[model samples]
Target: MAGKFIVIEGLEGAGKTTAINTVARVLNQHQICDLQFTREPGGTPIAEALRNIIKNGLDNEPLTNKAELLMLYAARIQLVENVIKPALKIGKWVIGDRHDLSTQAYQGGGRELDRIFIETLQTQVLGNFKPDLTLYLDISPELGLKRARSRGQLDRIEQQSLAFFERIRQRYLELAERDNTIVTIDAAKSIAEVTAQIETTLNAWLTN
Candidate 1:
């Protein structure tokens, strides 16, 4: 049997990192399956290097929307080829913090980039391997961004304006609406509540 694939998605401060780590531990405790928690932009060596560049903005110039989209795709392709597929083939549960939908949100909505172009790239490059489950942490930009800022020194991508984050949040909701595999959760709740929500969802999935 093919491995189960799970995706955890949300805005900058939707508590994705904490949830992923928590979920990984939960998965292990239940012995549901072998679980791996990883993130986008870099799950491999070369892709990680690319990730640093994208997040840090060492280029120190505004990245065009198209370039931003393509850069994300480039890293995603590397991730799929290098890590995700191989693990899934061996029956490992792969929990991606963010995946292609993120590119669609950040580049497509946040940056007002070309949608058709991105759809074409996704269709052509990432075929058939869809997530078994996608957990959407639904939260507004105002609430999410405030939490994000408190985390630490913001990265270049995180430095984007409130309007940009709003667009991305809207896009995430749009994706959840369109995709049946996604489970949207109320993210404005406390960390423990949000974590509990995620746990409940995963538990339900495992029972099915």
Candidate 2:
């Protein structure tokens, strides 16, 4: 059987890192070992370079919306082709910190880009490829930003207005509602509560 691709998605400060670790443990308990963990726009050297550009705003001028979208896709394509696909081919499960859904939520919704255009890009680049399961940790923008700020100085994307993240949150909900593979998790609760919920959800998914 082909290896499964599981993606964990959310805005900054949604505890995706912790959730990913929990997911690896849960999957191992289910005998799904040989997992490869990856994050976008990274997982490979080229992708990491792109990620720095996306996050740091190191460019002399502000990145255009279209340019930013293309760069994200470029990074994703590199990671998928070079790292994720190769690992999965060898029967290794891939656990991704974020995926294309992020582009839909952040760039399409938060940046106010046209959804249809974004969908077209996805189709062209990914073709029917998608994660077998996605866990979306949902949290309000204000609370999420508060947590993110506590970590350190915010990056370029992380520094977006509260209204931008609110739109991203709305888009994520809308997409999750339409997709059966996407499971929404309430991330406002305590860490223990969130971990328990994630474990339960993963167990149920494995059972099914």
Candidate 3:
């Protein structure tokens, strides 16, 4: 059987790192050890360069919303074609930190970009490529940002207004509602509870 692509997604400080660790542990428990880890907009050298520009502006040049969206696609395609696709072809399970869903949420919803345009870009760049399973750690923007601030200085996107992240979360929930492959977990819970939820959800999906 071909390897599966699993992605973890959420707003900043939504505990995605911890969730990813849990997923790896569960997969290992099932004796599925061959794994390829990736992060977007990164994984490939080109994608990493794009990620830096996306996270931090260059030469104080103002990055427009449209330009930002296009950059994201460029990075995504690089990672997908160069890293993710090859890994899956070789039967290595790929665990991704984020994927196209972030664009749908951030650009389409938060940036208030045209949904039709974003969808068209998705088709052109990614086609049918997507994760087999996406775990969305749902948390309010206030709480999430508060946690994010505790870690260190906020990045460019992270420094956006609370309203921006709220839009992103709303989009995430809306998308997750209609997508059976997406599992939403309440991230406000304790670490132990969150881990249990992820384990339960992933185990059930694996068994099915």
Best by lDDT: 3
lDDT of 3 by residue, 1-208 (tens): 7899999999999999999999999999999999999998888888899999999999999999999999999999988888889889988999999999999999998999999999999999988988999999999999999999999999999999999999999999999999999999999999999999999999999999
Local accuracy of candidate 2 as per-residue lDDT tens digits, 1-208:
6688999999899999999999999999989989999999998999999899998867478889999999999999999999888888889999999999999999989999999999999999999989999999999999899999999899999988999999999999999999999999999999999999999999998998
Cα lDDT of model 1 by residue, 49-155, tens digit: 77887888655686666766777888888888888888888888899989988888888889887789878989887977678888888999998888988988889
User: Comparing candidate 1 with candidate 3, which one achieves the higher lDDT?
Assistant: 3
Where does candidate 2 have its weakest 10-residue lDDT segment? Answer: 55-64
* Superior candidate under TM-score, 2 versus 3: 3
* Pairs with backbone N, CA or C atoms under 3 Å apart (clashes), candidate 2: none
Worst 10 residues of 1 by lDDT: 57-66
Q: In model 3, what is the error at residue 117, expressed in angstroms?
A: 0.3
Number of the candidate with higher lDDT, 2 or 3: 3
TM-score of 3: 0.99
**lDDT of model 3 at position 26:** 98
lDDT of 3: 0.95
Give candidate 2's whole-model lDDT.
0.94
Whose TM-score is greatest here?
3
